[model samples]
Target: MTWFLISIAALIGGYFIYGTFVEKVFGINEKLATPAHAQNDGVDYVPMSTPKVYLVQLLNIAGVGPIFGPIMGALYGPAALLWIVIGCVFAGAVHDYFSGMLSVRNNGASVPTITGRYLGNGAKHFMNIFAIILLLLVGVVFVSAPAGMLTNLANEQGGLEISKTTMVVAIFAYYIIATIVPVDKIIGRFYPLFGALLIFMSVGLITAVGFSSEHTIMGGYAISDMFTNLNPNDMPLWPALFITIACGAISGFHATQSPLMARCMKNEKNGRFVFYGAMIGEGVIAIIWCTLALSFFGSVDALSDAVHNGGPGNVVYSSSFGLLGTFGGILAFLGVVILPITSGDTAFRSSRLILAEYFNMEQKSLNKRLLMAVPLFVIGAILTQVDFGIIWRYFGFANQSTATIMLWTAAAYLLRHNKLHWICTVPAVFMTTVCIAFIMNNATLGFGLPMTISTTIGIVSALAITAYVVKVSKGKGDTELADEEKPKSAPETV
Candidate 1:
């Protein structure tokens, strides 16, 4: 109970303490006309209220990552809590903040363009392909989770005869509609309901955990937790926990999602709450799941067994059903289902935006929007046929690797300004090590080296990345404003 309360306090405090420091460092100008006003595309660059954009960003970045990632991470016992708190405040939230604000500064450009601006033309081309591929993978992965869940719920609960294949097609259809429509038409119209369910689900589960006497909250933390590695599976903390935790701590996926909201921000001041605050909100949700995984079953062993038998989806259903009763639990389950659906739609929408920018296609024409979207959906539908397990194996690594690049991008952005660059540089170096070590040590990916060898190589790689970042920083920057680098009448992508 003590650690849980303290952890909650720490997350909220991070918003005020470290979040304030980050905001000041970015130097938000409230009076600056944001793209929503400056560009006024009526599609992607539509002006949204601060609170509205904050909620959109929250639902956009969250998906199942915050819920599923942390539940899996909880398999590591109390060690997971350390990563969520520390990672969110310093690394994840910082990564999100810069991704958003930098977009706002640079005419709401996509990640490939922004990274290319800092990292150079080679990176732009790589990220152009890389970012779109990642989004396609996300769209496909998201489709399977919800469609399967909905099929089961409909058959067992709704008493309606339904098929997973039908649900998949239906979901894809909705994705096409959501991707093509203006932001305000569908997303803006339904988010209030979505937000209510999100609030209900997150708040209900946390309250249940707080009151349940079956296990103490401190059960999730321990004094020896600092020195002991308690993973029952013998997975090391170096890279396994980092990957398992995934976006609960940090993810490159959020870098792709941030620009979606950045284009719609009504004021520069809202960047802190919309981007940084949204990540904090996710950290709190991650904390709740970790604590539930730790305390609900009364021990890490029981929780590990549940995860083994049924996976994180089972943990979510079982815990919600036990704590919140059947009716409330169904709504909670629906909320979990909704999280990914929202993100899945936006993933394609983001891809369309990225492609529009890449080819200089105007989004105002319905024909141009469909021209890009048709091919993207074709690629996504084809990917749905691939073995999901194989695709998922790469998702986590791709997510973290993209995050590593974005952090370095942030570092380069600050370096060009001659501002304090280490805030991002430090995390960039650390994640470079994690990504390198994981790929090197894992049998399925790289050389399958011994941990000792992999860790050494990872550390050496970090030093090299640091030296290169400094070199990139010292190089010349473009002479014009970011907006000037872009077309004056350029509208945002959908």
Candidate 2:
């Protein structure tokens, strides 16, 4: 339990120390008008309270990723905890903060639009298609999983029964409403309640584990064991663990979620509490699930066996039900169900916003909103019919790749203003290498090169990219004074 407590404290401390420093580095100006107020459309860019934005952003980024990802990461033994702490503080939270605050500075432009300003049109265009495809994948997969679970639950109950198709239609209906409605109408009012359920689920499970008489969940974590990959299947921790635990540690998907909340934020200063703090909140949930998986089944080997047999979904269901009784089980199940559904709605919403921003179209009209939203759902419905197993594997790489690019974007933002750019530059380099080596060494993705060759190539690629970014960024320093107070016009360029 010591390591678990330590991980929890580290995540909390990250918000105060590192989070505050990042906020200062970017320089928040409360006196400046935000997008929500400057361009209040009531549909998407409406001002909202800091607390409400925090909860909505939290649910927006967190799908079932944190829960299921870490449980699978737990198969690597104590290594998962170390990554969750270090990666959350240094990489994930920092990426999220910039993704949101940068949007705020640029008048709530979408990620691709902002990427264009810093990285160039090529990146912007690539990210435009990249983000849309990833979001569509997320929306479709989330719908099918929950629909299947709900179908089973409904059928099992004594007198009632439901088909997967019926559940699918019902879920799709909610997604459309959530996607098309005003920010205040559906998301603002209902997300807080969903967020409450999520918090309760995490808190209750941790409480149960803390008071349990089972072997200390954290006792297995030793310094010697920290670097070792104890994955029963022998998957390398270098890339596999990093990719497996993306959401809890550092995920590109969260960066996409950030701009959604950036449009609603009332103050620039709230970026720390809403974006950075929310990532830490996800880290805590991840740590809890990692700890439970490592101990609840007696050993990491046992957890691996369970995972191989039925996947992480089964592990989550069985662990929650076993640890907490029937009532708690139901809540745990709902929490799992609610997670993907909440994120699914926002995935569609973000896609709509991205399309609107890309085409320079006004979104205040219902027809305009539908014009952007309908095609996305039509595509999503079609995707739900196809087998997504292989496609799903690519999301991890795409997510980390997007995050690597975002980190460089943040570093470029700092460099252009003559502030410290090393903060993002370092993690961006690290993740860039990870992404390179991962696909190269894996047979299914790349050429399945030898480990030594892949690692060497990854390092060379990182150095080349770092050199290019620094060279281009020099002599582009905008006056920090005016830049911070008024900021640059990002959306206008689009």
Candidate 3:
């Protein structure tokens, strides 16, 4: 029965969420423009074919979050997957698709740029600062949590000496590859080949594990029982669930991904497939990983043992691939590397866009090596000293706050221009309400809230700014603003 409900929810979510990408919410056809074209620079600004763009965008946005978030969400029982699937389609997918479309229409402007142009300079600067802080936090959490997970994997199966230095070297190698390789060429030629190999390996691993006699299927525990059994000092399901879904459902990073891909999309018609399809792919990955975690761990005690002795990565890898012996373990390790590399690349690209926009650097003229190298090193170094578990917890709340602010900005824009679509508005409202509710609950319960103080402050400031923008916008009247700039036609087909 639970599986049935989950299936239905997934289908519904996938359809609606993916549908938004296909259905142009804003009639964006007229607004698409020829992206400022230049010579192929073999690095950051390499022009990509539509298919290549789609793959890179998909791989970039769908990464470790799908795996880690779902594993964490499983603590609330399989029921949480329902919310993760639904919220992602309605909220996360919408935000990503439209944000990308908006960016593409504006010639690859970041969210803050779009907010600034549509909202105001004050809102733009504020959001930019907020985004940078969020990115750093995300980078810290991203690198450390995954590194810890990798460390765990190494210790258990490979019987290899897993240390911080080795993990750091592996991550550095990934960044170097990402820096020199043109994303277009990589996605166009290498990604398809690698993606196919990854899919086959992932399926084989799942099948091998599933068929193994070593696995056990216990009746899933109730969320209430699960929490009651936990130590009071430990993080609870309610807060953890909120944090887990923050990325899959809503994340500021999506805003960055959306715009860059939107610019490269051959036609606005492809947006639906690339944007929404990628999101659904992410959700599916999350669901699979979470199920693996639950099946492998079996109980909270087992989970704790893995975490305490091996770390979260150990818990994740053992639970995920333990049933399949050596092959499973190797596959799992390789999978971990692939997933994080995709994420790191996306993060690097998004961070570069934000920095370039902030400093008024020509998008095409920016140096990819410096852009990728500096942030990757800085984030990697910062992560080495931090406790990733705590950072992971904070990621949820901070991500929710970032999503909330972005949605609010989008909602205000729609309402102000009287161009509001129910599709976008509904998700915006739903996401905002849920995030705000989660924030309030976490704060009241003294669960340390999922986000940092900086994020909390940013959310509050964004709300105030949004409210003021709306109020001022109302006074100016929609007609005046609408007349200020005419909507352009979509760029002519190549």
Judging by lDDT against the true structure, name the best candidate. 2
Model 3 agreement with the true structure over 53-172: per-residue lDDT tens digits: 766676677666776666556555565566667777777776777677666556667788877766678878888877766665665565665566667667766698889668766776
lDDT of candidates 1 onward, in order: 0.84, 0.86, 0.60
Q: Give each model's clash number.
A: 1, 0, 12
Model 2 lDDT-worst window of ten:
485-494
lDDT of 3 at 247: 57
Give a tens-digit lDDT track for model 2, residues 1-494.
Answer: 77788899999999899999988888887767788877888889988888899999998888888887899899998889999999999999999999999998888988998788787798899999989988888898789877876775566432466778899999999999999999889889998999989988888887777777864566655777767788888788887888889988998988788998999988777889999999999998899889888878877888988987767877877777777877887787788789889999999999999999899999999999999999999999998898656656777788888899899889988888888888899999999999998888988988799988888889999999998888867777666336656733222210
Better of 1 and 3 by lDDT: 1
lDDT of 1 at 62: 82
**Residue 62 local lDDT, model 2:** 86
> Where does candidate 2 stray beyond 4 Å?
156-160, 214-216, 219-223, 479-484, 487-494
Candidate 1 lDDT, 1-494, residue by residue in tens: 76677787999999999999989887776656667878778888888877788888888888888888888887777778888999999999999999998888888898999999888898889888888888898898888878877787787667999988899999999999999999988887787679889989988887887787765665655767734667788778778888777676898889999998888887777888999999999898888888888778876688889988767777887888788887988998898889889999999999999999999999988899999899999999998888766676677888888888999999988887777888899999999999999999999977799999998999999999888878977845455334433444333332
Clashes of 3: 12
